[model samples]
Target: MAQQVQSAIPARSGGNHPKGLPYLFLTEMWERFGYYLMLGIFVLYMKETQGEGGMGFPAVTAYDIFGTFIAFTYLTPFLGGFLADRKLGYINSVYLGGALMGLGYMGLALPGLGFFYASIALIIIGNGFFKPSISTLLGNLYSEEQYKDKKDAGYNIFYMGINIGAFVCNIIGAFMRNKFDWSAAFLSAGVGMFLGLIVFTIGLKHYRHANVLKPAVAGDTGIGQVLSLVFLPAIIAGVLGWMIPGDILGSDSTDAFIAATIPVIIFFVSLYYRANKDDKRPIAALLAIFAVSVMFWAVFKQNGTVLTDWAQNYTDRQVSESMEQAAGKLYLAEEVSSKESMVTQYDNQFRTLKDDNGKEVKAMGRSVYFRNIDPARIPADGKPVYLVNTELFQSVNPGWVVMLTPLVVAFFAFLRRKKKEPSTPAKIAWGMLISALSTLVMVAAVYAGHNGEFKVSALWLVGCYGVITIGELFLSPMGLSLVSKLSPPRLTALMMGGFFLSTSIGNKLSGILAKTWYNYEDKSHFFLVNCGLLLVSAAIGFVMLKWLNKIMQEKGVK
Candidate 1:
């Protein structure tokens, strides 16, 4: 298989060009389309009732499931990268992973609960292979001299393509869900993934050269050894944790998950110790950055969790008849009749209840807003207000991603010309600090709303996303650039896995925070906690900056 892959490799063109790039880009874009499409509806699907063809889970449960799924998806890149580097070769793994993920997406559209969970498991494992492999391929392409200077720009462009898919998929999800059923929306994700597979196949001639299998390094364990040590122990530990624990992770599933990850995490840490002296420092830096960046992910990923709830129920979504007609025509606004709107404030005035079955619940009323608002603020007509869909708020980050990428690139370019640009680490610190400020915007919005007395304007939501997007522009891309710049050549994919692991942990934290939404009486404190977390993370990054910069310079990265 390795020989066949090697023989099929396109000859490298002169001047640092690898035979891949375009194929990888399109494959990534379509892969992101499927992933983001599923994400766009995941929360909504969870919150939906069984009568509506959903699992009918509570919001907290849904958040946990959502977080766990994304967490594991990022967590798997370690295995994927290893397999690509040692045994399977990049192309075969990509094909295998993409096929699994596409089928998983299709399976999700099937009608059984067992199928749903199984499909999610498949997708999660599949992503581990597909995600890091493509990224490593890009790095390998740039290893040639002609492309080395352009690697950062290439990654930025690739990142933009990712956001482009992310930006568009929500719209597709919205239309599909509104026009048909949730199943249709999920099915669309599968179709989009398959399309990505087809695009990758078409572009194979371009990237086949980059798919050459790398020889294993000295002292590298065999694939059998790795699987025995990592996968087998992980499975055993996970089963034991799930079976013997009483809420070790607050739930059996969570316990199993945390246990399942221990082996993988330990393996990566061991790599640092096992690396040759020349490789250790860079790996150490990568690990440090990974640790600090988890906090950013924890805070940033709230767009689909706590923040989604805020947009759904707290933001002022009311649109006038004329404006509604126009917005609806543009597919930007969703119209709900008075009876259908879920906008509600769970204030002291609202009496909680349960039937004999112990299913604690609240009474259905016009808008939940009436429960918390002063009498004067309640609408006299009792008519339901037309509001924008909560999912649209998910677009804000990507929207900012698209709008600000060029501007950010230009800003860095300007600084580059002067040689005054912040190091990538510095930019990430700045991103953390600026992101903290964005949370304060929400703090102000909460105060302005008088502690849930009235809903705030959607403009507030826009302002927050806009501010955070700037921080994201600084941090997210820079993180990727840092990984590309600092990782040892042999361990690039594993380090990329490290980067995603940070994201995975943060995503889980985001869910954990969102799970506490029901416990907070003063909502401003919730956002303030997020602000404090980011601020502390930023501080830590800043304190480490000089040392980190010294390493980057020693390593000869800009």
Candidate 2:
């Protein structure tokens, strides 16, 4: 990979992007389509009753599994990047990874707990091999002089491709699952991955030249060294954590993740101490940023669980019969009627609809909104209504991303033009602070809805996502750029891996917080915890700003 970075690589003759861009774009679009599709429905599947064809795991169990899956998914990219750098070329790694993910998605559609667990493992391993290689291959494209100046712009376009896929996948999921069954929804994800593989193969002629495997080089940490120093100790620690009697930190999985991180953290710190004199300050600065960034990621990643809970159970989702009829014609919404069997068995919420004569009747489903609707707002009894699909809420964040990206870019450009833009570190600090503010939006919703005994408006969730989207634009993209700018030349990939490690930890912590949903008596307290974490992170960033800025200036990068 380093050789590919420094070698004289060929470039497209014209000013246009290489022929690979469109192929990679479409390929990644489809890949994300598959990923987010399963993710959109995953928890819903886990928590559903067996009669509904779901796994029916307990809420905390489901959330813990979700967090572990998400954490391990991020964790493997380092290994994937390592394998690509050493042995498997980019093209082959992508092929292997895509194939595994496709199979995993298919496996998820099948019955049996064993298949489900094994499938999750396959997808996690596949993502490790697939994710970093493609990104690295894409980065190699801009290494050519022709594309150098437009590197950022190229990535912006690529980033939009990801959001486009993410935003659309949930609608696809809602339609497939609501119309047919869980099997159909999972199968759709598999098909999307397969389509991505096909597109990648079609574009092989363009990027194939850039996919060469890099041989072992001086000062590189060998696989044996990594195992002995990091992997071995981590595995032992994790086993110990899992084996300990009783729950040490909420759950066994959480305990294992925290324990496993100990050795990994030590390894990262050792990198700082072992760095050459000139590299130490930059490494320290990036490490500081990584530490602060964890809180942001932990809170931000709850979109799939905590936020999904709100969308599924706490918001007004019922639609007019006319609209429902129209949407149902296209299989676009979940259909719930006033039928007696539609109510979740043995758990009918206390509620009654009133007629013109003032007699009481029932119109209800498993949707929490209906379970707790104010009687005054209930339509005349025995009316059928359709609820907006729960999976559609998954699209909200990515939808915001699509809408907000250009605005954020223009805002920052405007600042840069006036020489008033915040430095990268400052932007991240403010991003955390802004994220804290977004939690207050949910707090307001909780109060407005009277602790969820009343169905709140969907606008509150949308509003929270809008604010967080701005913060995401500030922090996420900049964190990637920061890693590229500050890392020591030989250690660049390692630093990138380090950045992802922080994200993996944050992702797990999100799950830990989410698992506490049942523990909180008032739903408002759930969101408040998210607020507090972000506030603490922002405070840390503010305190470190002066020293971090000095390091950035010395390192001569933003």
Candidate 3:
């Protein structure tokens, strides 16, 4: 394998970085394009009226499925990373994962619950394989002596690729869904995935050297032991969790996921105890970071659920008259009728109103978006109102990433030159603190909008995303870089899986939190809860900072 890898290596191109960077960058960009495009509309599609070609699920149901879907997507990467490390090599795993995801996206275009579920399953499994492999491959590319020092910068650039795809896909999704239908938008995501595969195929030669597989070391656990001790028990526990109770943690999926993760969590903790002396502290440190980071993801991942609902229903999306025509042409606006029609009646909490007989009450009403607007601001009766598309708000965080990444990079570079730069663990701690503050922005938004009695300015969402994006910049890419730096060679990708396991738990928690969206009479309290969770996470991160820093120093990594 070593000889094959060395023989396959191409001479370095006349550039500061390896020739593979652009290819990997573009590949990840398009993969995220497909993934985020589907995600941007996932819950919206579920909550839309069946007459409008959606699933017509209740808002809570939509939130549940959204949470589960995202949770599983991250969860599978653990298995995928493990498989890539042990059986399928990195490049092959990427191809397999990308292909499965593309098919899954395309399958979503078909009309049926079966197809919907099957497609989602494919995406979940596919992402498991693709996500860790590509990231590990990129890290491997930088493992070369000539490129070792640039690893952090490389991940930042790769992360920017993810945001670029994420930033643009929502615009394309909005345009497609508006111009045609949900099927068209989903098909567009599939097309984007295929395009990414093409880019990956074109650059295979450049990264072939980095695709070498690592053999298990003496202390490493065997695949059979992992399957029996971890995966099989997880499956049994999940099944029992699903069957045993009535919403132990608010929903069946949440209960099952939490239950299932127990064995996996145990397995990770055991790795520290079982690791060789040389590997013990690094493993322990990574595990600690992973545990704290779950809170960040739990809060951050709500952009697809709770935050999307806020954008759709609470944010003032009204376009100015001058821009209305342009917005419509660009498919950036959705026109809602002011005319009232017979529909299910709901209270301010968006819970369905019921009669004494337990049947839903019906009444003539405008769309939900109009429920809280000042009567004076509403258009004359029977006229159409043009508002910005809700999915477009999904682009805001990524937009901030695109706009702020360079400034962030420079800011850190300046700090580095002054010998005042924070360590990776310190940066992650600061990230949690900054992220905690962002929830306060939403708390203020709730007050500004009078608890959703009136629409708030769109700038509020932008500001919230702006603040959180800074925190994301500090933590997300740094986490990846840290894993690469600290992981034992044979275990790198598996440890990457560990990072995503934290994300998976957090993603599920996001859904669980979002499910309570309707229960909050004072929406500010909801955001305050989120703020508190992050604050606790930040406090923990800071408390552990000295120990984590010492571990990193012992490992000879920054």
Candidate 4:
């Protein structure tokens, strides 16, 4: 590994930064394009009626699968990062991961439950390999003395790439799905993944130097030990959780996922105890950050679940003639008839109506979206109304990121110049607080909608996403930058895995929280619960801010 590191050519400057930055930025963008495109419609595809060319699962089942899928997708990065550090080099791991993900996305185009599960499995495994290594590689590039100071900015820029993909993919997904079908949208994701790989390959020469393998130190746990102690136990635990007589945590899959994470969590904890003195405090600090940030993801990840539901059924999607005409031309408008016909019906809670004989009950007249809409707003005489596709709302958060990144970068740059910038930990604490406020926006939206009696404006969703995007800008990229700065060299990728581990838990929690969406009649109460969680997380972050800042100072990085 040392020889490998020495033999590679040193990084060349690309203007003010490493030449590798643009390549990495674009690679991550297309990768996210694939991932988010699939995610944007995942639950929608699952819950749509079979007659409508969808899987036709009930809302509860779809939410469960959505949560589990995202949870596991993040969970596997733990193992992927470990493998890259010990055996496969970073570049090889990325290629392997990308190929698997591409196959998985394409596979989703096939019909059948078997294909769905198999494709999801491939994506989960691929993300495990792909996610952490790429971020770790970027960190290594900045490890060069000349580039160290710009690490945070580089991550911010890279994060924008991710959002750019995320922002655009949904639009593409909307066009594909509207123009063709769900399968076409999914196939597009696969194509996007391959395009990402192509971009990565083109820039390989620029980042190859940074992909050198890190040799394990005396204290490091070997792959064999991790497989036996962590991976095997997690499998057994998950199986036990699944086979248990009843659902312990909303559903069998959620219970299983939560159980499986116990061993991995214990493993990360043990790292703090086993680390050399120099590494101990940094690891401890990171663990604390990971714990608090879980709350943020739990709420933020709702965009695909409950948030999507809000957009699809609760938000006012009606557009003016010119706007409708413009969107329709791009195939971004969904046309639904207002005529009385046999259509799927649901209670106020949005659960599917069922007959006593275990059959779904259909209501005559008006589509589901019309139930909460004002009578005057409904198109009369059975006319078809064109509305924005629900999935396009998924682009809002990432769209905010793209628009806001430059301003945020400039703001922080000004602070840096004035020598008044908050430490990374302080920035995170503020982020948590800011994120808490976004939930309040949704709470207001619920009130404005009169508890689903009428549709609310789409701006509520936009406002919520806009506020949270700021919080995300503060926390998400900073968390990545902090991990890069604070981690022990040999453990860089592993620590990156730890970061994703936090995200996995949070994603699962988001699912769990979404599961409770029907339980709240007030709707505002649901957003309040979300608000409470983030506030508690923010409080804890602020409480530990000083201690975390100390660790950063001791480590000699900003």
Candidate 4 C-alpha lDDT tens digits along 459-494: 999999999999999999999999999999999999
Q: Best lDDT goes to which candidate? A: 4
| TM-score attained by model 2 | 0.88
Query: Which residue pairs show collisions in model 1?
Result: 16-145, 16-146, 344-368, 345-368
lDDT of 2 by residue, 1-558 (tens): 212212211221113555566677677878888999999899889977676799866666888988888888877766676667677777888899999999999999999999999999999889878876776666666657677544443444455556778899989898889889999999999999999999888879888887766665555577777779787898899999999988899889888988988988898888788777888899999999999999988988888888888887788887665687788787777765543333443222212233576333333444334567665545557455677888898898889877776566657656766878677788889989999999999999999988877888899999999999888877876776666567775454556677777888899988998888777768788889889989999999999999988887897654
| lDDT score of residue 350 within candidate 4 | 72
Per-candidate local distance difference test = 0.77, 0.78, 0.88, 0.91
**Candidate 1 lDDT trough over 10 residues, lowest sum:** 8-17
**Candidate 1, 1-558: lDDT as tens digits:** 223222322221112224455556667778888888888778878876666687767676888888888888887887887788777877887888888898888787888889999999989889989888878777777766666755665666567667867888888887777667778888888888888888778878766777767676896657797799998998898898789747766666677777887887788788789888887888888888888999989888888887887787678766666786766666655655445343332435222233578354545565553444355544566654556666777777788887777677767767777889888899999999999998999989889888777778888889999999889888887888788899876667767888998888888778777777777788889999999999999999999999899899999887
Per-candidate TM equals 0.90, 0.88, 0.95, 0.97
Per-residue error (Å), model 1, residue 512: 1.3
For all candidates, what are the clash counts? Answer: 4, 0, 0, 2
Q: Which model is ahead, 2 or 4, in terms of lDDT? A: 4
Candidate 2, which segments miss by more than 4 Å at Cα?
1-22, 144-153, 205-218, 341-369, 376-381, 418-420
